[model samples]
Target: MAKHYRGREETPKTAETPRLAVRYYPKAGKLQLLKRWKDREGNYQVGPGVTLDAEDLQLAAEALELIEEFVGSLGRGGRP
Candidate 1:
């Protein structure tokens, strides 16, 4: 019988947040966002990543708001 090592004997596992990959496609004239982990799995994933312009502020603003709101919510749930 194969002995399975329990949690205490098992090797430690390290967790990391997947990174976001951004690149500018010269031929398509656009910026793309790729999942670092997903890109490693297969080759058929075609993408026209998220498009952006030099003057585009909407995406930046929205990202900021989402982060702020998340942090603000955490603060509200804790006691002084």
Candidate 2:
């Protein structure tokens, strides 16, 4: 079985919602953004996630920045 290490998690205010986490897989030397939530039995489960490589980091950051700008503009009533 492959071993993975969990890093920081961004948890939701409600328990019913899935939390996002940053995980590392040493064997693959990769970072992933994954969701973790509880099942009906109260056991934690891992859901499908995005694997980000070195090349994708900058692109993802820029995309998120644009999203942030758009969201911010909404409050200011400005065009994004």
Candidate 3:
């Protein structure tokens, strides 16, 4: 079996309200996108889970642009 580890444990009402985080998983040797938000129960949830390998730079850039655009559109509107 492959050893696995996780990162980015976000929870409700955090001071930073984390914006999309990217992590490098050593065992997997890939970059993963962690977009998390709090549910009603204050549990962190990852939605639209994403992962990228070395060859996926273009896709990664595009996805980041889209996310930024979406967030910009929601300025001061409400939470994510």
Candidate 4:
């Protein structure tokens, strides 16, 4: 079985643009994209917002692209 790795890796050295951390819940059949942002205290805050369906491949692809763009905008050591 493939191991699932949650977002627990070390944060990059440089500031990272906001990236969507996607989670696929098989039992729920919904894709959850986490909206991450830094608080005023410079602490990381991740919240769940958009919920999509697995059957919608196009939507999923679009979401992925959007997330990539969001992360890439951060500049170096950002989301991949």
lDDT of 2 by residue, 38-65 (tens): 7899987876787645444455888667
Tens digit per residue, CA lDDT, model 4, 1-80: 22343424432222233665656666535556668788899987777566655456455788677866877887966544
Q: TM-score for all predictions?
A: 0.25, 0.42, 0.39, 0.40
State the weakest 10-residue window (summed lDDT) of model 3.
8-17
User: How many residue pairs clash in each candidate at the backbone level?
Assistant: 0, 0, 0, 1
Clashing pairs in 1: none
Give stretches of model 1 more than 4 Å off. Answer: 1-21, 25-30, 34-44, 58-80
Model 2 / residue 51 / CA error / Å: 0.6
Task: Say which prediction, candidate 2 or candidate 4, comes out ahead on TM-score.
Answer: 2
- Model 4 error, position 59 (Å): 12
* Candidate lDDT values, in order: 0.45, 0.58, 0.56, 0.58
C-alpha positional error of residue 54 in candidate 1 after TM-score superposition, expressed in Å: 3.0
